[model samples]
Target: MTESPSVITKRADFLAANRGLRVARPGFVLLAQPNDGKGKRYGITVTKKIGNAVVRNRMKRRFRELLRAQLPVRGLPDHDHVLIGRDGGIERAFARLAEELDDALARAAAGKGDPRRRRPARGNRR
Candidate 1:
């Protein structure tokens, strides 16, 4: 299908949605927040911890493809979503990636608000 209608291009948008609901899966972490915008927008982030520049770019590409394929059918319109790639994201099969994305979106939409689903804060060790 054609590329998703809108993309989250501005840094402000990302910051604005930072406190939104989150869904974490083995492959990726999804942050979703409601927006007043017209259509769905998305962003992908792959941190250096995941790998070097090439690896990060590859992860972003995979996330982009997932968004393009799934957003139209399963994404929430008027919402902003950011997909953060994790260590296994690149190595995971595309089909499984898509499946996880679908499940994450569904959970986000349902607003289940599972406290256990959140990622634990990193603790400093002396």
Candidate 2:
């Protein structure tokens, strides 16, 4: 029987996943990394930048469904998967998001991940 992927709840887990492979699509960014044989685990984050609480919750729900459907079979085994919502993701078609996720997973499996994005420097505090 196929078990549903486990949810990632710890803050450290999310931070660690950020250091792994990154695959950016128009809708969202996929981050995957080995979890020391912790099995298939996943997390979803929708920022306030995306919208109000209602919008963010909606986005999270959609992301959760996408992960549930795809992660068990298509996701990388023994890896932690994190999906960071993007502005376009809230309105993107579910099928298209699924397609992008599949493509992202393929690239990640082949070790063909996008370059890590550099964080901008924060302005000096007064």
Candidate 3:
């Protein structure tokens, strides 16, 4: 029997996945990492920077649908997948987003991820 992808709800899991391979597209970023023989797991994150609650929720819904449809069959086995929303994602076409995801997954599978992004220096904050 085929097992469906599991949902990732813990903050630690998200953070751990952040250290894994990253594939960035115009709409969203896909992060995938091996989970020590665990079944496939995934998470969706849509920050307020993307939009108001309604907009953020809408993006999450769309992402959830995309992952549900693609992750089980194409996702990396025993890996954790996280989808980080981008401002462009909310306005992009679903079909286009789907295509991008497929491309991203293929890249991840082939271990051809984008270079890690540099983090800006943090100054003192109030």
Taken over the whole model, the C-alpha lDDT of each candidate is 0.85, 0.93, 0.95
Tens-digit per-residue lDDT, 33-120, candidate 1: 7878658889888889999999999889889989988888788878898998899888999999999999999998898544544466
Quote the positional error of residue 50 for candidate 3 in Å: 0.3
Candidate 2 minimal-lDDT segment of 10 residues: 117-126
Candidate numbers, best lDDT first, in rank order? 3, 2, 1
Off by over 4 Å in 2: 122-126
Error (Å) of candidate 1 at residue 44 is 0.5
Clashes of each: 0, 0, 0
Worst 10 residues of 3 by lDDT: 117-126
Candidate 1, lDDT over the whole model:
0.85
lDDT of 3 at 3: 81
TM-scores for every candidate against the unseen true structure? 0.86, 0.94, 0.94
lDDT of 3 by residue, 1-126 (tens): 468899998999999999999999999999999999888999999998898999999999999999999998899999999999998999999999999999999999999999998766677433
lDDT of 2 at 14: 99
What residue pairs are clashing in model 3? none
C-alpha lDDT (0 to 100) for residue 35 of candidate 3: 95
